[model samples]
Target: MEPESYYFLEHRQDLWTFIRRNPEWYRYLTRDTERINEIDQLAKQYFGKTIPQRLEKAQHNIQLVRMLIDMAGAFRD
Candidate 1:
């Protein structure tokens, strides 16, 4: 394994898990060791780690909670 690949295993365990669970990325990372510098950005793109994605997820969770609370209120006597 390349020293750059080891960076994923040793420095970024989260990214290591992501790659392990994803065969496509695992192959890409291992094969294109030169692109290791871009791994952080690529992982962010693949994993939807951007701000908009996070905001959207938060909004969806809030909406689900609101709906659950409303449903519970409707069931009250």
Candidate 2:
């Protein structure tokens, strides 16, 4: 696989593991409309595509980043 694809898959797996480990924060992180919109915009800029086509991917990345941020907080000493 290409380096980009390899890292993408690895990051996705890590996100899934983090989600499983912290189910309680999932709903809250997913429901944040403001952050979601910001992420959507960034995805559009990064991918150079319009909505609906890129909506799902954007949302997924948003959730992953949010979860990672929360996980960092929880793990920080």
Candidate 3:
């Protein structure tokens, strides 16, 4: 699934809340080690960033979640 597919738009708030509550889950959801590392770096960056900055990042991250979910669905096929 492409990141711009709108799946993330529909579930953005829920996914944002989930990530904020369970940041570690990002590692589990993203099967790619590279992505995991990237997220880890991003997580570290989140510490000093403002809420708006984090929300902007969240918009991008939620698309990754949508991609992971779509990939999981593909596995069931």
RMSD of each: 3.0, 18.5, 19.4
Tens-place lDDT per residue, model 2, 1-77, is: 34443354356654435445656434634565234334434445545566675787799899999999999999996
Clashing pairs in 2: none
After superposition, candidate 3 runs with Cα above 4 Å error: 1-48
Best by TM-score: 1
Model 3 earns a TM-score of 0.34
Q: What's the lDDT for residue 5 in model 2?
A: 38
Rank by lDDT, descending?
Answer: 1, 3, 2
TM-score of each: 0.62, 0.33, 0.34
Give candidate 1's TM-score. Answer: 0.62
Query: Candidate 1 or 2, higher lDDT?
Result: 1
Q: What's the distance in Å from true for residue 3, model 3? A: 51
Report the lDDT tens digits of candidate 3 across residue range 1-77.
23432244235554455456776755554544335344444555555355777798899899999999999999999
**Cα lDDT for residue 20, candidate 2:** 57
Q: Which candidate is the best by lDDT?
A: 1
**Model 1 over residues 1-77: C-alpha lDDT tens digits?**
57757755678876776677765766776677766667667677778897888999999999999999999999994
Task: Estimate every model's Cα lDDT from 0 to 1.
Answer: 0.76, 0.55, 0.58
